[model samples]
Target: MALCSKIIEHDDTGRYLTINQIYTEPFPSAAASGKLRVEDNNGIVWILSYRVKSGGTRVFSGDWPRFVQNYKVKAGNTIVIGMNGTGSTDHKIEVM
Candidate 1:
């Protein structure tokens, strides 16, 4: 029982996103697939992969420093991913 069909992404301005494009039914395995969408300062959108269970972004990347430095993601800008989860997990993504 985990967050399924989830997505997470950040923008050039450091705005993060997490959306559920799949579901309406609990397939579990079906929700395992990643489905993230991000919008940058330029208004361009990007799709991010789902965070793998407990392993986290280790399979992805750890860019807290880089993310903090590059984007103003806090407060209204604080990017949130995996709403189904604790929402405390930080998935690293280097926005280029």
Candidate 2:
């Protein structure tokens, strides 16, 4: 789906990730208020919930700490989130 965003310092420290508004724009209305299944490149999976705040959406989950720990993602990294298929409920994550 070509959805991608940079990992900011806040993401690493706050244990949460922000989904850019450009990416969220195409999400189904319900998606903005629900959980999404995000899978990393190594097949690790996390269920992240979306929150609408300050006119934008951010995604976070209880497993965020684990994900960060396992992935070793740092600030300034690029994280890409893409749907597995058309209308699929699962999204894949790529770190670069």
Candidate 3:
């Protein structure tokens, strides 16, 4: 299932992808609280730290910048995060 589909912001390409409260609740258990295994469309697995900041905002940091770099992601691109399968810790990301 798709967790969220968001437009990449300038700051998101810099250090992390910030997800607002509306999108945070659907994340799988592994991604909602700690380190998550995110596999890009290219099948590259990136380890990103997932945390809820004050005010209920969520973020995926750590290697997120690297992922942006590798994909040449930019502002206005649509990024989608979803579960690879039911009850799986693996998540899939696609940039379009």
Candidate 4:
């Protein structure tokens, strides 16, 4: 599955990346709250924890700061999240 969303202010300072509702809808129930591996454009993998919150689903973890810094992500940037076939571990992300 492939998903895309724009970076927001909170994402840059809160140490959490929000997942859009459209993308979250197709996720398995268990994915609502658990660890997930997200790879960046450079193929660096980050294990982030996700959960459904009042606002939406957010991906976060201790490595969030490093992930953002490494990618030089900023508010207004667009990010694409790609997952290989269902149940696949090859999840990747790209910034544009």
Candidate 5:
């Protein structure tokens, strides 16, 4: 299932990318306090730290910046994040 399909912004190219709250439910709760594994289209696995802010906003940090840079992600690019199955923390990303 698709977790997020966001148009990248300049700010998003920084240290982290915030997952929209609406899609937070499918994310592994363990990731709420630890790391989530995401495989990019190139088969590279990115270990990203996940956290929930005071108001339930979800964010991914750690290798996210590297992933963004490696993928040449930039403002105006669109990225789709998805999971292979329900309740799966192993996710994938597609850049367009």
Candidate 6:
């Protein structure tokens, strides 16, 4: 399948993009169990987890209990997302 992304029109001053919400498809087909990450322009890292919620995958984390998880991505590279639990990963993003 193809990947999709949306641009948020708002001031990102003194902060980074927020992942206020995340949605994935079904497991074994859509859902993935593991670490979710997002790296911004800074040099920080945010990790999260997700499972199928209703009919899509939803991410959650206690370490980053904000509207969004932020980080500083590696230049020339996208943020990296990896699976770290006893399960499979449907997809992944590099948090850098």
Highest lDDT among the candidates is held by which one? 3
Runs in model 3 lying further than 4 Å from the true structure: 31-33, 86-89
Off by over 4 Å in 6: 1-30, 66-96
Q: Write candidate 2's Cα lDDT for 4-87 as tens digits.
A: 556657545356776645534544542555766777766767766655556565555566667767777778777777776633
> How many residue pairs clash in model 5?
0
TM-score, cand. 2: 0.72
- Superior by TM-score: candidate 1 or candidate 5: 5
Cα lDDT for residue 73, model 6? 27
Cα RMSD for candidate 2? 3.2
Candidate with maximal TM-score: 3
Candidate-wise lDDT, in order: 0.35, 0.63, 0.80, 0.62, 0.76, 0.36
Tens digit of per-residue lDDT, candidate 4, span 51-73: 66666655555566777788677
If candidate 3 were superposed on the true structure by all CA atoms, what would the RMSD be? 2.6
Which portions of model 2 miss their true places by more than 4 Å? 29-33, 85-89
TM-score of each: 0.27, 0.72, 0.84, 0.69, 0.81, 0.34
Better of 2 and 6 by lDDT: 2
Q: Which TM-score value belongs to model 3?
A: 0.84
Model 4, position 49: C-alpha lDDT score: 68
Better of 3 and 5 by lDDT: 3
Error of 3 at 87 (Å): 13
Residue 94 displacement in candidate 3 (angstroms):
0.4
For candidate 4, the 10 contiguous residues with the lowest summed lDDT are 21-30
